[model samples]
Target: MFMEEVELFAVSALHNTATSPRLKELKVQQENDEVISRVLQYVRSGWPTYLPSHEILLRPYFECRSRLSTIDDILVLDSRIVIPHAERLAVLDKIHSGHLGITKCRSRAAQSVWWPNMSQQIAEMVKKCESCRKESNVQQPLSFVLSFLVVLGKN
Candidate 1:
């Protein structure tokens, strides 16, 4: 989704807290640093109970933007850390397709990796996308006759 949409959704979420019971329930499903922080804030403000899990907090937030459901559904709270299932699936798909080596996959999955590899992976996926491939051409170099014709005078 576009960054504008994401920002707008986030702002809307913060603005209308009334329709957030589902959101609250979702957030309560996972425990993460952000959830803990919010929970702590609530406690400081005098709430007696601990905050819900990050997943609990995320459900309503994601539901607010349906496009994000695919990504949200795969996320799990593991010892307070959020894991992305899409990235894992992408890596697995790449490996299965013989596009990525196990070592490269592991390296790419590491926290500190930069954008180059990720961009490469995205490019590869785009190239392999059947819908896109069917509609697009893999442009090739013109033959000498075709190339030289442009230099010749028009009839």
Candidate 2:
């Protein structure tokens, strides 16, 4: 009975986007066990199942107890999970591209269960990236002498 309820909920959630009248009616009447049972049986027979929500699957990856620590761990884990040398290279390439923001990279790294050193490693890697250095903003170094001079001039 529990399984049946779960199946019904899953089906209803999956088909929430469906537009057909029959589907709409089924969705409306979805609270009933008989309707759920029929849907479950139909799904079990041969009909295609709806794609599960990406948000549902990805929820755990983003739910970190400590954002900073978890993000670091994820990066290290990512290094291990991305097995193929080529895949690693590809990921590096993406990192090099401006398309992959720092936060996104860190989040992905955290998801991978990478070591604690992952965030530091990523920082070092970014620091050494010539392209980022060239394209990114360079902050002017602050000087006390400049500040003093500006104050004197104002006076």
Candidate 3:
């Protein structure tokens, strides 16, 4: 059920003119990615039920086998683009461009793109950003605000 919503959003995102130029570049990059190419093949053909020792590297793709598919030759997981490893960093940058923090960045990424360990990568990126850390440190009032809310709720 949630996959349906994601697919709908992905289709809409692709139709959005603001991102078309970048999407074109992404398509070319995805095609050139050896791993993504192999994954695409797996998506097109039936995925093997069991991975031989040599195919161990594909375990991540295998895990989400049911959700994998292709739209216009671009591999997708449900409706989200299966970002190639080469583009993951760039995608993460765009996701965190507003410095909105880890949760928002992950939400933004979830809306349009995906890859293995995407949430973990977002957390790491936000943690490493000095500006984000400084902002987080200055949030001493957050605890006070929560306490105040709790006190008010008990009245």
Candidate 4:
């Protein structure tokens, strides 16, 4: 409770002191995010509560403790990464930058961050990304490649 209050105060100060409009706007959104606040509260209290659409994050769902930890009273996962559920889609957008394929996106997120069912979620998101689908390389069959090589050699 104390830590969350302090965080709120700091965020309030940050909003007031922000010099740029964009930064202040971003801070406002962060302050409003329920997922970030809930995680912080959970880490401080050491008790988990499942909310609507968040039942997957309950204790029994975790495969291992290696990826979970708390930093400065805020929940951290996968090497101290702070991933609020509300921000998952936004983060996914960044990780999928350059129109990465599913494997690349999965590997990228795996290295730095995690949440419940994170891998499955990332796969779905990558699959639905329009840019990635449009830009993905089409795989050529072995026969086609060999035939193309033979034709090139004859030419």
Best by lDDT: 3
Error of 1 at 50 (Å): 38
- Per-residue CA lDDT of model 4 for 13-34, tens digit only, reads 4365423343344334434666
Tens digit of per-residue lDDT, candidate 2, span 1-155: 22233234334434653233432333333324342333333333532334336434323323321231211111112223211222333444444455344566566554432322456656666767776666456665667878888889953
The candidate, 1 or 2, that scores higher on TM-score is 2
RMSD of each: 13.8, 17.4, 5.5, 9.2
**Clash list (residue pairs), candidate 3:** none
Query: TM-score of predicted model 4?
Result: 0.53
Ranked candidates, highest lDDT first: 3, 4, 2, 1
TM-score for each prediction?
A: 0.26, 0.28, 0.79, 0.53
Q: How close is candidate 2 to the true structure, as a TM-score?
A: 0.28
- TM-score, cand. 3: 0.79
Per-residue CA lDDT of model 3 for 8-123, tens digit only, reads 54776567523344565667888898878887777888888786678776788888989998766677888788888997887778788889899998887887789989999999
Ranking by TM-score: 3, 4, 2, 1
Model 3 worst lDDT window (10 residues) = 1-10
**Model 4 scores what on Cα lDDT?**
0.55
- Weakest lDDT window of 10 consecutive positions for candidate 1: 73-82
